[model samples]
Target chain A: MDREEIRVAVLRIEGTNCEEETATSFRNLGVEAEIVHLKQFYSDMIRFEDQRSIFDYHCIVFPGGFSAGDYVRAGAIFSARVKSVLRKDLEEFIKYNYPILGICNGFQILAELGALPGFDEDRPISDRPEMALAINDSGRFECRQTLLRVESRKCVFTKEIEKDKLQIPVAHAEGKVVFPRGREEEYLEKLKENEQLVFRYVDDKGNYSGYPWNPNGSFYNIAGICNVTHTVLGLMPHPERVTFDYRKNSFGDGYYIFKSVISYLEKI
Target chain B: MITFLFCEKLIVFMIADVHIELKEGVADPEGESTLKALRLLGYKRVKKVSSVRVFRIEIDTKSKEEAEKEIKEICERLLANPVIHRYRINWIG
Candidate 1:
């Protein structure tokens, strides 16, 4: 499909504040991107014209923000609502190998929905979440620029970025990625072996550091990851926030992420 | 009519209190901060502190066992994240 033919859906609901920037990122790339409400896809209360089908879009972007107020764990409420209503559509979306990107709170939602570390191939969505994005070790909301080392090129979202490290802004109180206790080592090994590990938080010197350098103190300093299919990706950083051109020196390292998605869709 | 409504309320409403906390190994920053504050206030004997989320859930069930079962499912599926936290359910009749 042509780049223009790529219909990207930047999904949002109440409290999801990043949809506009996410959609604009795709629009800047000359693709048709729309900020779609979760209600539009599932709620019957919406008008016929407003209601939409998930299958209508080629790519779905779950943008950042505290959806449904991030109560009862950051993304649990939103994830449960999605599962209750649109689980089949999401499963089918994953089955067909379309790209799904989740940033920050979106990352938490994907994990809550069992879409990350998607261990079971026959079942893309796990019956229960195997991992979680827990509260920051700092005990407060952290908002700052973070250095991320690109650990893998296997994902459809990060394939175009040739750089070893990129500076992206991370804003969240619950961005610490943790697997279930006792299974951490085994799961980490499996993720490494599968090449599903996407990005790791690092310091300016490119070393895996602790505390503020690692921000929320994510497990293994992991900043992002993908599923076995390499299509569904969940990361804590806000790539959309940096896609603008004003930062000439860094040249918006995140722009390549959207470009990679566009390139991947074009080939399909 | 008032007695009937009161009796009906007694049979219909059941409240379960759930307390959820991060597992022993998982880091608890809020708990740690509370400990720090206590230390600063000269509470030297207080060795540690932990934080927990208390959820009071009202479920419609006739028997206590059914209420417990339903609340347990609710905690497992929504209130608690099994990956990082463990939860206990208490029947508050």
Candidate 2:
């Protein structure tokens, strides 16, 4: 579709701090982007003009934040709220191949909602989340810039990114993506076979490393993943934080994520 | 200053205790940190350290069977993430 027709909803709830940056990045790309409160889609008290439907947008994003204070778990409250209130409509949204991008806490929410590692095509959102973004191995909030190797050829968000690796900032206490207790090996193999794995943490030399390099100690150094169809993607890094070059005002590493999906939408 | 209903049961308040912790094989960073601190404080004999979070919830149902089923569903849906954490529910009279 045309860039003018590409409307993006940078979705947020209270404590979601990145909606402005995410929406600004999209607007910079010449597309229509709005910072939409999650309530606007559900609250009956919202004025008619202020109300929104997920179907009203070409794409929707869950931006990074300590949503709902990250209580109980990083994204549990937010994800449960979404699943309880907007489950049916969200499933329908996925059916249309509209890209859903989740960054940082957003990634945590998607994992909680069973939207990542979504194995079955027939069920875009699983009844139970197949993965979890646990706390960092450091036992403290890790805020640092990490290198990521683009690991998926099928991911719509990164397809236009010609570079094999990108430097993105990650700031969160919980981002260590883990599979079920004993099924780590099995799930890793399935992710590889299905090509749903998106990004892997790497070192300066671009090799998978440990400790500060891997950041949260995510299994297989996995930094991001997507659903089977690649329409949905969830990653720990904040791509919105670095979408433009300050000096040249040119596109940065994260800008291509937005660019690629818009191009994909244009084609489909 | 309030009146009690005559039909109210004398002992009907039900509580379900949910104990959640990381799966056995999963790394417990917080517990590990605590263990390290204990060792530094001269407690060298401490073999290991582990931790769990307990949530006490009041279920509306009076029947034990119904309360058990509802608590299980609650644990599965919201109280705990099955991927990294496992939970055990205990009933309190």
Candidate 3:
């Protein structure tokens, strides 16, 4: 596929606040990216010209935000709406190996949709969620620059970040990644074996630490993860927020994620 | 017996109060903070506090058992995150 033909959709719905910056991140990489409202994809009330098809884009993104007010659990409403309406389209999208990225509340939506911790490679979408991003242990919204150690090179989104660690900002009250109580070890082992684990929260020294360093007290200090195919990714950090190179002493670590996806889309 | 048969013919409305709470081992900062606030207010007897989300769903079904089952399905599928939270259903008709 030609790079000019690559189209990315930064999908959004009511209360989703980060679609603009996320779309801009892809646009910065010289690709066409649009902030597409979820309503435009499924709502009958939307104007005919405003409606969109998931098949039109090569990449889809669920940007961070408190969608539908984050009521009935964070991302529950958004996830349910998508699953109720766009499940087949999304499932087909995944089966086709198109890239899907989720950040913060977007991550929560993916978990709710059972699109991450994808243990069954044959089934790109799970019938039920296997994990969750629960409330932070701190009991309050945590907004800070968190250090993340890149743990997997197999993910298409992180192939360009050769560095062992990245400093990305996270702002959420529900970013703690947790698995089912008794299945933690088994899940971690499988994730490690499949090389699906993408990032782990680490301290400034790149060591797994506790409290504020680990932010939400995520299980095993996990910050991000991808599917077995490495095509679908969900993370609690906002990569788009730090993709600018003009910032002081900026490494623009997040820019590489967009670049990596663009490269993958170009190759296939 | 006649009244009971007639009652069955009438539409029955029920409200299911579903309460969802984080599992015992999961950390709950909101509940903990509320506990701390109570402690600071000199409620020395308070030991622990946990938070739960309550969802009241209205259903129209003739059989209470059927209503319960449907509400349970809703709770399991969408009302709660089974991974970290457990939900209980209480029906009031």
Best model number under lDDT: 1
Evaluation by DockQ, superior candidate among 2 and 3: 2
lDDT of 1 by residue, A1-268 (tens): 9988899998888899999989999999999999998989978999998999999999998899999999898989988988889888998999999999999999999999999988776788987899999989999999999999999998999989988999999999999999988888999999999899999999999999998999998999999999989999999999998886574764588999999989999999
Q: What docking grade does candidate 1 earn?
A: medium
lDDT score of residue A132 within candidate 2: 92
**TM values, all candidates:** 0.95, 0.94, 0.96
lDDT-wise, the better of 1 and 2 is 1
Model 1, span B1-93: residue lDDT tens: 011245456545677789999998999999999999999999989988999999888776666777788888888888888999899987775
Measured with C-alpha atoms, the lDDT of residue A206 in candidate 3 is 80
The parts of candidate 3 lying over 4 Å away from their true place are A249-251, B1-10
Ranking by TM-score: 3, 1, 2
Q: What interface RMSD does each of the candidate structures achieve?
A: 0.7, 0.8, 0.9
lDDT by residue (A166-232, candidate 3, tens digit) is 8899999999999999889999999999999999999888889998999998999999999999999
Residues B55-89 of candidate 3 have per-residue lDDT tens digits of 88887776788888888788777888889888888
